[model samples]
Target chain A: MAPFAGYDMPISYPTGAVEEHNICRRGVGLFDIDHMGQLIVSGPDADAFVSHTVSGAVLDMKDGDARYSLLLDDKGLVLDDLFVYRLPGRWWIVVNASNLETDVEWFTLRAREWKGTVKVEDVSEATYMIAVQGPRALELLDLMGTPKASSCPRFTSGEIVIQGTKNLFGRTGYTGEDGGELFFPAQDALGLWEGFIKAGETHGIEVKAIGLAARDSLRFEAGMPLHGHEISPSINALEAGFKWACDFSKPDFVGKKALEAIAAAGVSRKLVGIEITGGVPREGYDVVSPSGEKIGTCVAGMFCPTTKKYAANAFVEPQFARPGTEVAVMAHGKPKSGVVVKRPLYLPAYRR
Target chain B: MKIDSAARYQASHEFARKDGTVFVIGISDHAQEALGDIVFVELPEVGKTFAKGQSFGVVESVKAASDLYMPISGTVTAVNDALGGDPALVNRDCYGLGWIAKVEATKAGEFEGLLDAAAYEKEAGKD
Candidate 1:
């Protein structure tokens, strides 16, 4: 089935969504993320230019290290969430597939207006992203390539030779598990995917060829905010609980001033997790207090596989931000009980 | 998968089995397959009246939520309470134990509009 990201993505395997979630939680699941955009920001001024365009401190990052950041307009609304990596001479910016065309256009327009030099090129077609997520992901990936579990830290990546194949590897995952995501050529994807599946068989790894359906749920459980829902141009990063990504200490970056103003003014709204006691909380569900008072709105909600109950994340008035705060969700014309909880519905088992 | 001809179906993916006044209602095999895993089921309350083609409840899979539309106008007499604790039963045995609700048909000719197993297979695009 097609998904909101504008891809006719698979909902799950013929075995179904339950099996796919279970497979990834207990074993490992492979996902085809070829549709995501990969851009190379090179040239002599790549480092300085990237720092100016994004929200995070780029100069502090070392080669091969990856940091989660957001590209924002001058007004402080997020254009998109992206992963930035410091390569040898240039930088690599990986953006959401659905926003590829828009992101390229936006970045190119800014690059042209810049007083300094920065070469931004779209390299999406040349790269293919495959994510191996779940508890057994690292082990399964190691079988296909070299094992670097002990050395590689979380949110970091490196160039590794796997199964005689040279590929870019990162110790990151959307699922709340210890795993890695690899980037290689589209031609190499099918082979490496099947190879991992075969190698994972002996280790009791259930190979789930996951699609976008499970991808959304996995990211939600990991407390990772999405672009359109949680971090749109109308939404502020601080309100989306991404204040950590904004660095004022850096020389300066887009939206830094606006973020500082919001932070100082005290956030009017903030993102918080909610567990639905009465029903499945879905995206766009209205948030209300127990007495029929409107508080905020849910951006993402799902029936959590791990918890076996309904869970959601919402951007609510900051007064209701405390954990255990009682709330209500309006669904099917009925008000259901909900409560504010921790940020991530589940904790990620990053390879520390 | 192949569709079973003996199983009667509806365009909305609902399946029905009639015996005099009582008809067992649930989604078709094609639906269960298309929906992937059946995680949560919100069956209509017993003794609730619904018009034909009206939404009675919802079926939540791991990925998306599907509304369960009434195949025929009727009053809900009973629900499959077992689904409350084991919703996956819908995925495992959708036509049998996974049945949604038992209804007392409001109109006699409503059942005639539903498709037989053969017609349903074609409508579901399984053929």
Candidate 2:
């Protein structure tokens, strides 16, 4: 186990990260993602409060629907990327583990400034989240007798009962594959994990216990953004390639004016995909032009198991952001040749 | 993981075996296990020379990249070119086909400083 956001998280099983990653692509993989935070917002003013605070269209979401959104500071810099689920009567917000406390505090302080009644509760301690991802994920879920797991559409959620315990789940995941994230009480975590393992065996599916290392590689290959790596307070949503999440048509929202201005003036830098030929380019490595002049820095990089090559995402000048542009990444103190590719180095295999 | 009985070991987990005047060098089984899956290996040229304890090559796994050190000062005689295409050979068979390089030892007493299998097993056991 390795330390991740104060949790003793598994980095990989004995099969190693590569095998686990391959299993997720070919079969099924399970993850213990209890470190993520769960926040509940409810009251008379909850809808308006949520819609105004986040960059996504929150109020338009129907019950059992979820949307990817972002919270931004006053200057339009992203504070955290999150998923907002419209439950029966409350809004369920799932934020990154490291930014949980800060996000809760921000929501509480903002609630006080609003005119109507709004209550925000931090329910992270009482929640346990498990992710089942990959091509055969739904088949395993169906074999386990999880109701609605097979029929639920993407970005939708439903409640289910497993082992006589009530649980909630959403057809969402960080891996660009088909999956569902199960949420239940903390006390039932062990039973649910073992139950899934047994169910997988009964159905002849190769369901392996995945770790954070493989989780990162899988998500990286799918072109998903990590909290600290891709989306951060230093980067705005537009430059981070999340302009779609920012609803400019909304009348009033935090960072709306600034985002509109940025959209009009156009962004100077853009996040782009890079394929390195020589060595692996890790986070914070410098991206240079053909003549070896530094242009930007790599925000996230790794040896993509699916692509079988080193790839990365970096924010570079607009001219260098186009696909097929020649660039170089500094790895091990030497510049390695690469090309700027399109976002999502691999096409998503999501069952939408 | 098995430690070769005929090979000499370094504290950093490299093994050197004498065949005539040339020493076949590779990382130990314990080192390969610790690194997980081997993805890439950067080997020295066939004729490169290095001082004792100098970094001679690189071995990268999914988790990290580490510098492979020389056990003794010598001139490289041969490199296992097969590792360039399939670096996982080090993880699958670290003692035999996974041999990284063969070096012509520069001095006669260079093998005297390395530890035997029993001593290395004890040394590796502590971690």
Backbone clash count, each prediction separately:
1, 0
A270: Cα error in model 2, Å: 2.1
lDDT per residue for candidate 1 within B17-95, as digits (tens), equals 7856688889987888777777778888899999988999999776578999998889999999999888889888887
Q: Compared with the true structure, what per-residue lDDT tens digits does model 1 show for residues A124-204?
A: 898888888887777776666665643677888887776676778877767787777788877777778778877877676
What value does the lDDT take at residue A272 in candidate 1?
A: 89
Give the alpha carbon lDDT tens digit for every residue of A225-318 in model 2: 9988889998888999998898877777788888888889999899999998767778899999999999999998877888888888999999
Instruction: Kindly provide the TM-score of model 1 when superposed on the true structure, using C-alpha atoms.
Output: 0.91
Kept native contacts, fraction for each prediction? 0.56, 0.39
Candidate 1 C-alpha error for residue A50, in Å: 2.3
Model 1 ranges off by over 4 Å: A3-7, A113-116, A147-150, A202-204, B1-9, B19-21, B62-64, B105-114
Two-chain DockQ for each candidate model: 0.52, 0.61
How many steric clashes does model 1 contain? 1
